[model samples]
Target chain A: MAASVRTIAVIGFDALQLYSITELIRRENDYVILDTLDEQCDIDSIDAFIITPSEFVSRFDLFLTKRTKTLILADKVSSVGMDMSVSVVAINSRLSEIEEAISVLLNSAECGAISNSELSARERDVLKEIASGKIIKEVADTLNISVNTVLTHRKNISAKLGIRSVSGLSVYALMNGIIK
Target chain B: MTLFNINSKLCDIIFYDSSVISVINRFGINLGVGDYTVAEICRSHNLDENFLIVIINTFLNEKYFPERLLKTYSITKIVNYLEKTNSYYEQFQLPNIERHFNLLIMKSNADDGNLHLLKRFFDEMKNELLFRINFDRQEWFPQLLQLGNTTLDEDIELDNIPESAHPIEDKLNDLKSFFIIHLKGKYDVNLCQAVVSSIIALEKDLKQNNRIRERILLPFERALTE
Candidate 1:
């Protein structure tokens, strides 16, 4: 099977460095480099965002939201202060290392996208109440939330946990010590 | 997705999607089906070729539910096929999954509590499935068989036969997701892969079985009673 082409955005590089990086990436058959990161650029469509360290620092929150798919281009001295959660590739590293970093980011992003099992605080509250044998109305009353909100949380919980049955949720709660 | 017809080579169909081997097995068709067309196999087995084709096509492609075609077949035939599928599950699929799961846990670290939770989840799922199978064998199938011939018992609630807030197939999917996402620590990758593949196969089988039951069998029974 042919490898799926990965869409990438090269951000925060000077004209000379950006040209060199884009040329190197273009030589490979499996990558499509976006022209520019402008307002019209669909951020989510890019599978991997290759950004310079200065740009990452300036827009830390934006990159943090997509940390799994973000690859930071940084020198060794500047990389020490970078968040360990995000992958870092040296600015002057060999082409192979940069390619490998992007590949790793894309792979991890795929796996991460497969399952988002973590429950939010409100979701945890709802789960605990529901798993304790409370019906939807009762859960809403306990949480001081509307019935529709409770239902929405229930749906989100099921989607995240990959479980829809109250009994299954109860078992998960008991096993995970979310509820006694 | 190829729509397999009566004249289609059974071997070619099998080669196209090997997973259909289990579907064929449920029909009492065994392997070494050398160079035989579907029609030829159906002739040898005294099977309905159209029914077999419908089942195979539905199994191969999720969107290919020929409801009109399915309703033409006798309920007895559909029920018998479903019973055979249930037997396949009880006799093979469930045990096979548990065996792989047991091996997976054994190969992992002894102190891992998450594995124990997963086993608990599996046990619950297994119980639910067995309960469903028993319900089918003891109550639902008999009622379905007696639909047009004899009146159903007044006390027997037909709607409750296959009812569950959480379907057994979804639990299998949950187990699969756990393996793929939440499972952490050192363990046997080969054994883990075996368990995941087995779960996925069973999940697919169950979903297909459900489509037949929900779309074909139940609606046919309802129409007959009406």
Candidate 2:
């Protein structure tokens, strides 16, 4: 499997606002802008969404409850229902503030306390190897398993943990002492 | 002049053009005291007076650096002074040149594909320099400083590039050739000239570092280990 870079989508931004925001985030190497709300977007792969209050209507279900982190503008924060986990920034926040919000949201998930009682011993071995920077073929070679088995184990791990990126998994391993 | 053989109080080095500061700044000797002359500043800092004269003349004429004269002064001292000049150049000049060069290539009638590739090459070169200098400041310089203060005393200066595991001369030549091969008729004349000046400045820095590594650091480290 390829390394995962988190995808962020900006919703409800006018053309001028979209350009400036995209320009700011463009400097960061870790992020990839999936698309603006102007066209059909890949909602399934989106790791996070940046939406204004008026535009939150387009992805109301996402705003309410989704495993993915959502960044809501300040003006729209008041209208959001209780019992939701979302980061809020000022209506006219600077680039630094947006960066802070994104970092906090990305790190907020407690992957350090991952529960893997369901994973088989072989799956656990594959997880540890991949998290330690081994590719699928290397993991298979190291464990004396077929490459197909390694791919199956990776898919199962992503499905179970809902964590996709290599960086994210690397952090999880470090935090949980799965890797040094 | 042995600090007193000539009249120093009324020298004309600083009185002509305000831009003369570019020449005078090479000494890293400042006029901190309101009533001091260039002689007094140089004497206090232990700088070579003859070398200062040559540097100032070169700066005034907009000529390339006098590479042969580098051997006459304390190489570490010259490296320290040139490193400061490099800082000032990066802060005040690099961005302006990059922006102007980019705008020129964008508006030119040259082959857009090759021009764009050249632009990317230029950007990569600039980024490599900026990142390398930053790493030196953040990691290598600090480590050297700690070693200097702890044991070497007057023997080690922060700008002293140590006897590295690699050759410094090859790196210097590589930097020079990168500029020569890329910066030419393809670029606007002013842009080419500005980039050449930048390359020369970078060369002076590496050359001084190489001198220090060979002259002072290698012997000093060998003695310490022995």
Instruction: Find the candidate with the highest TM-score and give its number.
Output: 1
**B77-146: candidate 1 lDDT, tens digit per residue:** 8888899999999998899999999998888885747777888888989998999999999999998988
Q: Is the docking of candidate 2 incorrect, acceptable, medium or high quality?
A: incorrect
- In angstroms, the error of model 2 at B119 is 2.8
- Per-candidate interface DockQ score: 0.24, 0.01
Model 1, A33-148: lDDT tens per residue?
A: 87477898777777767788788788788778765366677775342324434666576766655654554444444334544546756678989999999999999788765454
TM-score of chain A of 1: 0.49
| Superposed model 1: Cα runs more than 4 Å off | A1-118, A171-177, B148-166
Model 2 scores a TM of 0.34
Q: Write the per-residue lDDT of candidate 2 for residues A1-180, one digit (tens) a residue.
A: 233576777777778877776676666446777556554765667766777766666667866766455666655234322333555565565565555454433333212123332444555677899988998889878976545446545655554454444544554455345677
| lDDT score of residue B87 within candidate 1 | 94
Identify the candidate with maximal lDDT: 1
> Per-residue alpha-carbon lDDT of model 2 for B81-172, expressed as tens digits?
54666575567545754666577676566652444544454555566567756865676555444444322335334354453633333333
